[model samples]
Target: MRINRLIYHEGKVTNPYSVAPTSHFFGSTSQSDPLFWFVYACGPLPHTRGYLLFGSTLLSGWPVSTVHRKEASRFVPSSVRFFSFHYLSSASSFLHPLKMEFKKPATVLNLANIRQALVRMEDTVVFSFIERSQFYESPSVYAPNKYKIPNFSGSFLDWLLLQNEKTHSLVRRYESPDETPFFPDQLEESFLPSLNYPPVLADYADEVNVNDEIRTVYIEKIVPQIAAKRGDQDENIGSTACADVDCLQALSRRVHFGKFVAEAKFQNEMAHYTNLIRNKDIKGIEEAITDSAVEAKILERLIAKGHAYGTDPTLRYSQNPQSKVQPEAIAKIYKEVVIPLTKKVEVEYLLRRLGDDDEAEAQDPQRKTQLMNRLLSNSLW
Candidate 1:
């Protein structure tokens, strides 16, 4: 991966050899004395500890005029020492195609290695001692209190007594601490917010139980506000029709089953959707149409708020096919409004169904009881 660039004197001199005989040879010789300069960049090195030498110097007749004494004399007078001569004499000659080698020192763990070995040795010693003690055959070695018994029932009773003794000994060795005092004075009061709401009484509220009234109020007041906040936060999440109904149906089934779905399953669904879009499937196109409509609506809202258009030159044109509005027409309507309207309608219908289900569950206790019973039966059987 090394690249080398060579630069030399730019000007050219006429060669007396190629020119007419009238030209002076001395003038042409100036061109032959061109100084060659080279710049080299060697790509990433393994150890970054080596020295570089010019490989060209190893070639035969290199420093070309050095072999010719007459030509060399022109550059270097007889009194002057030739540096090239000294360099060639001292150069180490090696075999062609030198094989480069790198040596890395073997790694050794210090005190940690010794500590680990010692710990393992201690464990082995403890295990061996336990194993050796277990081999003792005399019953008196384990328990000296057992009385001599000859009858079959007496032997059974002796064995049971030995087991009970072992159990009691082990239990006495390891026991939990005494229970903490239960008095309020001994307890530290936590400053954390209380989850329980206080009772609210009214003439109309009297018909409903206090707990039920509180819960109903929470659902009516808190739940809708939470839902609205979530919807606002997720406003930018582009809505598109599910590319694979079968996959979506599978996901819906898993949601209904309350089973854990792996990340791979979700990624597979995303990949499937991407492939469908790449293949220009009708469903994918429909999804794109729906998303485009949503994007247009968002853009319209931004424009109505006196927001400046984005700086991107490509976005100067509305993405709609029917949009013929000029770039300067800031209050222009999107051309393909019908598709988004249709998608909005479809989404609104689904939302309404969900809302109706919530309302039905809240109003009808019988329905709730039946649903709970069905879920319980499904789980059990």
Candidate 2:
């Protein structure tokens, strides 16, 4: 079946030209049926009017720029759009400089765009795991008061993380909605000017911080599995804290990405989520947002990435080339911890979504707090 729907996004237009099994850009197919996908965006940028098409088939007659449709070869008058023809398989996809402008909600909030960003983040999370694996568990790094600081009462890692956050906050790291700080209570204001990003989520989006849960699971569940071996290395304590910070931030961003997923899903299916939230159907809301197929694909893709990235490319000819971190273990962490926590954030965000409506009874201060606590407590993974 061919799809010719035009998707309009904040002055931008995306048209999925067609789907066909025989087309060639990149695609997968089974014997019984062939699945194909192609999408292109034509829109305005500050300094350019550009177009980009991503798909398995190169169908002619689609617009390549602000130019009229059907002129795929004709370039735009003032802006030059270079087209990159390539295949994008999970195993062979290469990393490049990706600039996802958040200046507008259109470029930033689209599910397709969000998916691209998430895929890039997987590389980061995997690389961070490999880095941390170079050292032992470094238990001293996490043990409280292991390193004495005059005013600090937490672990060496905590002190380092707080310092890291405070420094980055100056450049407005936390200003980005996807960033959730472990020490949210103490983040300093930015010295830089505000980005004034167009608001994309509900006002209560900031309250959906689950870094507490993310950190707990990372320390108790993930770190041990991915590290070199159990036990602390006194000399490597500092390096360990830094590496652990990277892993936590990557995981935090990935898990908290649920906000974007939830907002996108809620906006796309407002009526369904509205009903679930209005009736306090937590289970139903979770079911509606959950896509088992996508989740499975994510696990499978991550497993491949873990093996691909964790191994040395030069050692391809080596017998039984071992990856620094096990591919299956990465998938397992995502399946059990990352995916569930993301969904939890989605559910919590949706429950309070109606708070945007002034008429909703959830606006009562005490009632809202009590209700959220009760809901969150009962909704444990």
Candidate 3:
């Protein structure tokens, strides 16, 4: 706990003061007394507790600049020195107070702990080097300066490259099958067969319900391709499809502007009819409108009526003499009623075709070409 100086020579005690009794104790000594007394003492006590204690305190008392060299020369070479001075009762008792007053001594580390520490240290050093380089040098020199450390050996760069390569590979693996060419480009044509609507009178017959039949025909012939096109459009639009008008417009342009225009007209007609039914004076009309079967039947009847007017140019003229249908009235009827209905039917048919192809693609493990040739075929140019 304290440093004290004593001098013993050849079993005889020496007291420089000369005023003390011949007892074991000596009077207080000055700074000069220890040096004079130690000269006569045994040649520097080597490898002893007293020698170590004397040497450490002596070296520490000197200026810091001289301490290392002085201590190295005095202490035996490679001799490990363990300081054991206790101001506390036990190690455990000292821990709490030591923790409160100073940083805790780190526990002895094993190989794994050392490895982890080294990794963390390496990361810290790398980040520090990057920060310093960025602070002092031009951005262009950052990479070269970062890799220029003498001991770096490029292992870190190699590890980083390996990690990046692995991440890229994982991303590619999860990518859509269509992206990786699972189906041939020509196979897209075979997925759906195209049919032309002949301009025949039977095709436009009053009894002939071509809406459902047309829908079915389109579905059977063209749905798959539409679905494929839809998937491609979805990719083009990304997840923000609905919100992005520019993207939707681009996709619409790619598909067919005419198709979209027709569909819009059809939707307007359906909405008009829906409004008419809701506002109708007929009792139980609301209930009938709500009924899926009733709505379907009503829609079928309207569609048939609309087809008759659309197909038969001769019958389209007003037969009543008292109530002459004006050209404007006829145009309005077609614009507000017939054109919209036809558009709705066509749009619904196109959508159904797309849906069927989507379902097929989902079920089929082998990715068939999931893009529409129509996009390429129906170019505006």
Candidate 4:
């Protein structure tokens, strides 16, 4: 049967007549909120007549109205079925094409897929480090209030990042689950249509950002080790800052990919992670998730990549190939910083696995049940 019409029922507990025109959009944030409905068409439908169908945004191929659930039930033909709110969002996938297909079971959510993604990101980080090594350690870029631009009081790099975030936000870059902006507070809504990427991580996954710490480590540790020399260059301040942004964004994404890793691990062994989370055993959770052997492999792989990509094949210095950034320094970075931060993210994400929402959803019985159901549905998506 071809279903054409789609009427949304707000399902409010109040009298339908009392529904004065208030907000046009109804996006409920909590599970305990009154359930909504999507009344799909079966056959010929009655006219909306606009009787108490107030405060609703218009829907195409269907009446632009919100009816009481009981009133909505009157049009419930054999084809109509109840779906969770998450399903309502998922259904939007049909209208607005999925931009980031990270929700599928066989695609983005698994450990194997995540590992491949992480490996690719390593290449970006290595290349970025090599690029940054072209410039001297431009201390002016990181110094406070180094470039005095109107209405902004921060480092040159900070100002650049803010402008970059604002520009990217216009095209909806931050809407993608994998992206997290350093200047989150200043980001504006996209001029483009909303792309409802099917949920892959927790609702609060964005909050698990470690960009601040990443920037700190990059300046304090990574730059000093990877830069060409100790002197600051006046000519390369902008170029150096630009390269820093690239490295920071890459590192941020690589580290935060741990969220998906954590989610996949938690789903595979729910009971094990659940008990660990419940016990507040941070050490226990860390040990269970840690694979020292895997870490060693990553370090070895990164050193090899640095040697390959950081050096010119045709060139040699002495008996050894001349490299842009020292291969050992690259290995040392993963061993000291990237791996540890990733583990921190995994542990934090796992610890919040049992929470009601990301911040606090445990005490609410209904929210907990809904959370479990949502996680299962997302895993099966």
Q: lDDT values of the candidates?
A: 0.25, 0.69, 0.26, 0.70
Q: Write the per-residue lDDT of candidate 3 for residues 1-381, one digit (tens) a residue.
A: 222222221222233332112221223332432332111111222222222122212212311011122332333233322222221112212211111110111110111222233233322322222222212112122123343446443322222333433443344421211111111121222222333322111111222123333223322332222121222232332222122222212222212222322222322233433333335423332222233553344345433433342333555555732212122333343234333443343333333322344345434534322221222122211
TM-score per model over all chains: 0.13, 0.74, 0.15, 0.68
Ranking by TM-score: 2, 4, 3, 1
Q: Which candidate is the best by lDDT?
A: 4
lDDT of 2 by residue, 1-381 (tens): 232322211223223232222222222332223322334422232222323333223333331112223332333222322323222111011111123455545444456667778888989998999999899998788888877799989888889999999999999999987788889889999978898876667888888999988888999999999999999888898888899999999999998889988877876666677788989999999999899998898999998999889889988679978899999999999999989999999999988888646235333446545643453333222
RMSD of every candidate to native, in Å, equals 36.8, 10.5, 39.6, 17.0
Error of 1 at 105 (Å): 58
lDDT of 4 at 325: 96
Error of 2 at 224 (Å): 1.0
Off by over 4 Å in 3: 1-325, 354-356, 360-381
**Tens digit of per-residue lDDT, candidate 4, span 1-381:** 222223444445354332322331233212232333333422221232221221221232222234454543454443442432234334332222222245443345556567778888999999999999999988889998878889999899999889999999999989988888898899999879998887778777888878899999999999999999998899889899999999999998899888988987876676677778999999999998898888888989998999999889877455777889999999999989998999999998887776655335434346646755554455432
Model 4, runs deviating above 4 Å: 1-100, 103-106, 316-320, 357-381
Per-residue lDDT for 275 in model 4? 77
| Residue 75 Cα positional deviation in candidate 4, in Å, after optimal superposition | 57
Give residue 185's error in model 3 in angstroms.
35
Q: Quote the RMSD, in angstroms, for model 3.
A: 39.6
